[model samples]
Target: MWITYFFSSLLRFISVVFYGEITTDFKPCIEFFYAETIPQGISGDYQALCQHYENQYHFATLYDRNRRIPLFSAYILSPGDGPRPKNTNWMIEPRLVSDKVNTGMEYQKHPDQNVKNSQAVNEDYKHSGYTRGHLAPSGHQQTEEDKEATFTLTNIAPQMEKFNNGPWNNLEDEMAERFKVCTSKMYVITGVMPYEKDEPKINNRVTVPEYFWTAYCCPTFTAGPDQNYFPTYAAVGRNDPNSKDDIVKKNTQDGHDVKEMSLEDLEKILQNRLKMPEMSLFKNKCKE
Candidate 1:
């Protein structure tokens, strides 16, 4: 079976190189962003959200079909300067609605096997008292195309305005600065955790998250006194301002609560909450 699979893959590669197209009997939903790792045991239907520009994957997301939002978005940080793009237009993924929607064969299987069309649009946030939070922030992107790709609704979730503009924004800025100094590639994964009680939904469309979590791994960095901490870092921020200080303490002055911890510690918390004892965000925890 292994030999057959290997030759089949080889043939596909060769066909693509010569014919500019390759046919397959069965093709799995390819998750381009999970080159490092993908979380486990997330209920509800999920589809890989890939934003392609110029025949390349600009960024990827794990979109939740039921909730009409992204569970997480992953991207590699690139260095750039100057003001970021502001004219981003939020758009829905048509392929998520139907496989026949001409997405350049991005979805190989039936559309039902992919994300459902929950129709989460910009108007859903209107008068809903929530912000359109970006899991993969545009600020981290280097090119205009990459930055614009982050504007898709599939890459956003419902978040409190305070949390989105306050502590969460600060965390993203810090990450950008850190990535600028890293000697090697840095992979960042940002996601949200559902509320334990009274889960809120915006406009009866998008479910609001309780906590927003982020983790980054920089396998290579400049040697420093804190070299051990340079490789990886994890953090969780509170999205509900009124929620108790169980996971993340409330910071009244800052308008949001955020706590930084080790990647291992974050994984342990996720294991219990996500009910996946083997949940790993980074491949082998980004071990050297």
Candidate 2:
């Protein structure tokens, strides 16, 4: 037992140094952030995830176990070399349910009582009229395992059908294209904004978000076509058609379109809408 434990610890350390996984810490997965920095001013009932899958760390997510959804997912933008994974074998993080469980994510099998009670499961989303939207979308991933890793329920939120398939997905495609031309690494953080009060839920479990938001900070980059902005950019899209046309406007398809803005402006909007006195998504807004 002791020998087995030693090797496991050794291997985990190697992963942290070489692959940039943060498995054991109060702030999990700092390696996923640029300059080892995390977003500030977020509080109230959340868990940070290293996003381990198939013995690898794919990204980072700040999960709300109470709401059974991710507040945000942060990852280094890859060139997205191949097609999206066809498999829908979504997964779950066992550590979220029990700290004693020491393993990477596992396939989302039948939801036992503890698993069902602790987090959202496949049944919670079955016929729930909402798609299992990914906070770190698979399309942004370069490898098959990383793409598959994004399917974990902990990194997912309940998204509207048209919104996910339409504007939101389109935004992802555009970001991918923009990232392809960049000469340096780009760190992207995608997240959702829940209603300030009496948030809605699906299957009485997973909380649905009112709006989806994403931002990227590229400290240094070679300019692509139609390029003027640098360092950081952001956008927010409406998940509800009935929402007011302020941050994002209505489109012809009876849905809201994505609106891009400066990273600083986006933080102010999040601070106001989420009711936090202050909010910052990146360290120095990625100035350094």
Candidate 3:
């Protein structure tokens, strides 16, 4: 029964992705992965500055001076237009700037590919010894192909377990519920933020999420894009208690004792925290 519902959704999804209603020229970035099954259309590699998971997947990480957080796209698997996964926990990392020739199982380091000298750290942010945390959990992947795509670096964010489980986990929960009812095909994007100018800019490829959001249109659930359902999203962690903003900078930079969020809060929390437009589309569907 579940498989039946899953495939039904898959058919609907494929129809939209392959030949849906959008008349725009927007084309998704595509990368191929070699695994047991065909994976999502777009996936990223990890930044070279990162200490772990470099050889696993492709990521996309671009530094934005204006916006404290790095802009990022989450990993998506093609599900072959089937029922949504009973699971949606997959860790994602943003890809760093690299040439096509150096990606995907090719280890040739591009001369320019080493984490740009400008962005590379020089001890300001200390090794902190912490592993960049992933909001999307890879454990949910059912196939090797799905797992491979989840391995991308673009999907990752430097995070502590306390933060990942606390308010951040809340935001992910909200996103999952919103997706469940979404009838239109959709794509989600999330990124991390760094401290304001002067907090010793950590060049260590570490990231803090200033906010996160996603958007999609599945007319099946509505006659048109239902901004109310799963609009764009933006969410910030509670400011550190010490910093007046209540945001937690880094509790244990030593990297020992990783924190895990509550398994139960993972879903609904994402929905509640994400702001409406951040949850909806950039432009009103009617306007578009």
User: Top TM-score: which candidate number?
Assistant: 2
Candidate 2 stretches with Cα past 4 Å from truth are 1-28
Q: Is candidate 1 or candidate 3 better by TM-score?
A: 1
lDDT of each: 0.71, 0.81, 0.35
- Using lDDT as the yardstick, the better of models 1 and 2 is 2
Per residue, candidate 2 scores C-alpha lDDT tens digits across 1-288 of: 999999999986665443233233435567678778777776555677788887878999877888889888999888567787886687888888887877878885676888877788988888989998888988888798888888889988998888899888998888887886666788999999888778899988788898999999788878766365568889898887777787787765777577888898889889888766678778887887
**What TM-score fits each model?**
0.80, 0.88, 0.45
Stretches of model 3 off by over 4 angstroms after superposition: 1-70, 74-102, 105-131, 135-143, 200-228, 231-234, 239-288
**Residue 60 Cα positional deviation in candidate 2, in Å, after optimal superposition:** 0.4
Q: Per-residue lDDT of 135-218 in model 1, one digit per residue for the tens? A: 988888877767776777788898888889988899888888787668877888898888776778987768898889999888
Candidate 1, 149: how far from true, in Å? 0.6
* Clashing residue pairs, backbone N/CA/C < 3 A, model 2: none
**Per-prediction backbone clash count:** 0, 0, 64
| Alpha-carbon RMSD, each predicted model | 8.0, 7.5, 15.1
Task: Encode model 3's per-residue lDDT on 64-106: one tens digit a residue.
Answer: 4222233443333123333334443332222333334333321
Candidate 1 TM-score versus the reference: 0.80
Worst 10 residues of 3 by lDDT: 31-40
Give, for candidate 1, the lowest lDDT window spanning 10 residues: 20-29
